[model samples]
Target: MHVTELLKDWPCTVTGGRPRVQVTGVTERAANVGEGFLFVARKGKRQDGASYIEEAIQKGAVAIVVDRPSLSELPLNVPIITVPDCRKFLSYASARLAGNPSERLTVVAVTGTNGKTTVTHFIGQLLQGLGIRCAVIGTIGIFIEGRRMEYDCPEMTTLPAEYLHPLLAYCESRGVTHVILEASSIGLANSRLAHCEIDVGLLLNIGQDHYEEHGGREAYIAAKGRLLHQAHAIIVNQDDTQCRQMADASERPTLYFGAAAMLGYSTDLILQKLAIPGHYNRLNAIAAASALIALGYTVDDVADQISMLALPEGRLQRLEQDGVQVFIDYAHTPDALEAVLQTLSTICYGKLITVFGCGGERDKGKRAEMGELAVRYSSLVFITTDNPRNEDPVRIVRDIKEGFGGDCSTVEAVLDRKDAIRQAIFRAAPGDIVLIAGKGHEKYQQTATGVLPFSDVAEAEWALSEKTYEGKVEGGSR
Candidate 1:
């Protein structure tokens, strides 16, 4: 595409580069620049992107776009285009380049600390069962019409605009009617979902999961609240005060679910037949039903078939066993970890054995909190490693031990995740439920050195199959 075409609404001038250069691809990172690519020098939170201009030019970046339009330091013969906000411009430019696919289909974006994946999954299931063709973009993977699409991008859940718009375009081309996706707090604050025309936005519940990343809970809430502004209609949690306030302030056509309601369906009708466990999942179902109702489906149309909604993989997933039960769930946050433990505590006939760990390089504040929660619910707790990416496993375990407050009777530190899982499962007897948390559906383990192949369900199954190698995990995959 021509530079003239890409910078349609934004202010630009040819300056010293070619009068009409074509941009074969676009990127914010200078290291990813290749021949004929347009390098966008975005000013990030930690690093100044303008510093990499020479590096991008060295890698054959044909054109450059930046919010800071200064040519005194930059070399001559390169197009220097300016935009008011390069982060927002990146999303809009990618959308325009991808033929504006979000406008062609209904977009339902879900934002929350814990239930974003589950709510998105339930919405797709309900809408698809109602005869609407649907596609899902989430942490598990991208699926279009029930088929997972192949992707290699920087982000796993909320992708950057360059990768996101094209996938939305492909879903549009494949005859999809609705696109459901999970929007993270950091992703929304950075403007990744800026230009997408969201038809219905679901606010599951705001929790203090990324306090360190956003600086505090208020900033995090404000960041995720950006979705409410972009949405035409909102379906929010009436039971949560923060979510209710955010949705009410938007003043858009809003619907409510959970406990109270302006216009919502009763969850009891579906909970009677709902196969998925946990009280949180009951709320996820109501939120999914409300979102579809806002998209023109009647309440009666959604609730009847919503009982068939299955839990997303890695979320309270069950594994096969004879004497004891085992589960694998992706509950990394404090709120999520507590919720899963609380749910399992109710069904546990004998003892609840839990193995969980915190991800390094993230909000360190939640590590100790999760430690306390795990000990409060489980009879035995193994504080293991979960994605220790470039951080010392010993130091991470020490941080989690702080939550025990000098009483380590219930908590034990096992830096090796696989060993911790094996010990927990081996110790379980009849009527006991063993839970492997934190890295549920993840297939890799990131230590201080590097990433290695790992899977909780596979490890747990192997451990369980050892007790009696004939048993296999049945109906576990999503």
Candidate 2:
């Protein structure tokens, strides 16, 4: 495409020269620039892209798009386009460059603190079951028709606009009729999903999370509420007060989903049969059902299919051996942890042993709250390390211990995550349910050194295998 065509819709003034250039690609990172690529120099939180203009030019960046006012330091040899907001411009420009694939398909965006991944997956399952080809993009990585599309883990829940537009274009080529995406608060706040057209937006429950990034609860809620205004129709969890406020504030038509009837919105689907456990999961089912219904699917049409849909990996994933049931869940927040443990408390025939830890560099306030929940709910609480990225593992464990209020009898701080899982499984008796919280479905553990291959489900299976091997050895000796 010509440089003038890409900037035609974008608000910008081109200077340097009017020489027409054929742009093959667009990128923000100077290292990713190639021949005939348009390099966008936008100011970031940590580093400024403008600092790498020389590097981008060195790599054959044919044209430059910058938001910075001072372009005196930049090379004036190439066509320079100046815009007020480069990030917003990049979103629309990249979409245009990628052929605006999102506009060609029905895109449904799911957003919230928790349940974004699961709810997105549920929506995909519902769509695929109805013989509609669809794709999903979220924390579990991209998926096409229930198959893993990418082997590597995504760095964030939502892909950046530069990559996202192209991915949607690829999905369109593959005959995907609908696209279900997990829209994160940071993604919305950063304008990652600004260009993508959303047909139905699902807002699950919002709780205290990413406090450091958003500053406080109000800012976090406001950031999440951005989805409400972007989509044509919004589906929200009426049970969540913040979500309710978003629904009420939005001018778009809204659909409510939850156990309780709010404003005469019936939640008859909550009582339907579901393979997944927990009341929270029931709420997720309602959210997914409501999204499909908003898209014109009948309740009865998807009711039977709902029971066959599997829960997303690492979400209350159960592994059973010798009457010991081990459940691996990605419950990193205090509210999520409480809901998972509370659900298990009702089903536990014996004791509920919990092994969990807080991630480093995140909201420190949730550490003690999670600790208190574990101690109050579980019979035995094992505090261990969970991706203490660039932070002291011992210090993270100490912060979690503080939440116990000095009740160290039931709480044991085991810095090693594997040992924590081993302790829980090795000590479990018949009918006891061992809950492994945090880092569910995650294949690697991030630390100060680097990310190491780790899986909670894999560790639990190994521990169970060792126990079975030990039983065989002892019995054979006798």
Candidate 3:
């Protein structure tokens, strides 16, 4: 695409030579610039992309889009496009450069504090079951036509437009008719999903998270509200007052889904039979079902699909051996941990054991709340590390210990995650349930040194196998 054509609908002032340059790519990172590429120099929170303009030009960026006026001072002969908000413009320009593939496909975005991944997965599976080729973009990774793509970036739940638009174009080329994406609050606040045309927007639920990033709870909720503006039709969880407010704010058609909706409508009873454990999943099913229904599917058409839907990996994933059941979940927040533990407490036959910790440099306030919730719901608690990046792991544990309201006998602090899992499994008796919280589906543990390979499920399984092997050896010897 020519430089002029890329900026056709974009609101920007063009300076320098108006060369008819054919742009081959778009990127914010100067290192990724190649021949005939457009380098976007936008100011970020910590660093400014404008600082890398010279490097991008050296690496063959044909044109530049910059937000800062001073950046145009460089005596580069290439065309410089100046915009008020380069990050916002990047989304539109990227979509235009990628042929606006989202315009050709039905896109559904799921947003909330929790259940975004699971709900998006559910919608994708339902669309696939109905013979529609679909793609999913969210925390787990990108999925196109029932296959997981190699694109994995844990830093952000939603991909930036520079990457997201190209991925959508690729999906379109593969004949994907539908796409489901997780719309995260931070991503929306950063205008990541600005240009994508959303057919249906689903808000699962909202809670205390990313508080530091958004400044406060109100700002966080406002960021999530951006999804409603971009979407054509909105589906919200009525149980949550904030979600209800979001639904009210939508000028487009809206639908509501929750336990109350399920009870009020007889046909929605299929939500109760979801194969995934927990009432939260039932609500997610309703949200997914509501989205499909808005897309013109009936309850009967998708009821069976909902009943047979598989839970997303690491979402209350269960492993049972020798009468001890272990559940691995991505419950890092206070609300998420409480929900998972509360559900397990009711079904657990013996004791409910929880192993969890908070991530470093995140919302530290939630650490103590999670600790308190763990102790309130679990028979035994093991507070361990969960990606203590840069910060001292011991300090993070101490912050969590404050929530315990003085040391309790049931709560034990274990710094080593492997030992924590091992102790939890080895000490479990028959009919006990062990809940491994935080760092679900993540195969690595981030520390000050670097990312180290770690898997909660793998560690738990190894511990169980070791215990079983030890028991067999002792019995044979006796």
Model 1 residue 305 lDDT score = 78
What tens digits encode model 1's per-residue C-alpha lDDT throughout 305-358? 776898888989998567789999998988888889989999899899999888
Regions more than 4 Å wrong, model 1: 12-14, 30-35, 45-60, 70-73, 260-262, 468-478
Model 1: how far residue 1 lies from native, Å: 3.8
Candidate 3 on 1-478: residue-level lDDT in tens? 8888777776778888666899898888887789989999887888889789889988999888888888766678788888888888888878888889999899999999999999999898888888889999988888886688885344468999988988898888888989999999989998889999999998888898889889988899999999988899888887899888877877987777787673235445676557777888888877888888889887877786877788888999899888899999999998899989989998998999999999998889899899889999988999999999999999999999889885889999999999999899888988999999998888999999999999999998887776653356321111
CA lDDT, candidate 1, residue 247: 87
Give TM-scores for every candidate, taking all chains together and pairing residue i with residue i. Answer: 0.93, 0.95, 0.95
Worst 10 residues of 1 by lDDT: 469-478
**What does candidate 2's lDDT look like per residue over 327-398, in tens digits?**
999999999999999999999989999999999999898888899999999999999998899999888888
RMSD of every prediction: 3.5, 2.6, 2.6
Comparing 1 with 2 on TM-score, the higher-scoring candidate is 2
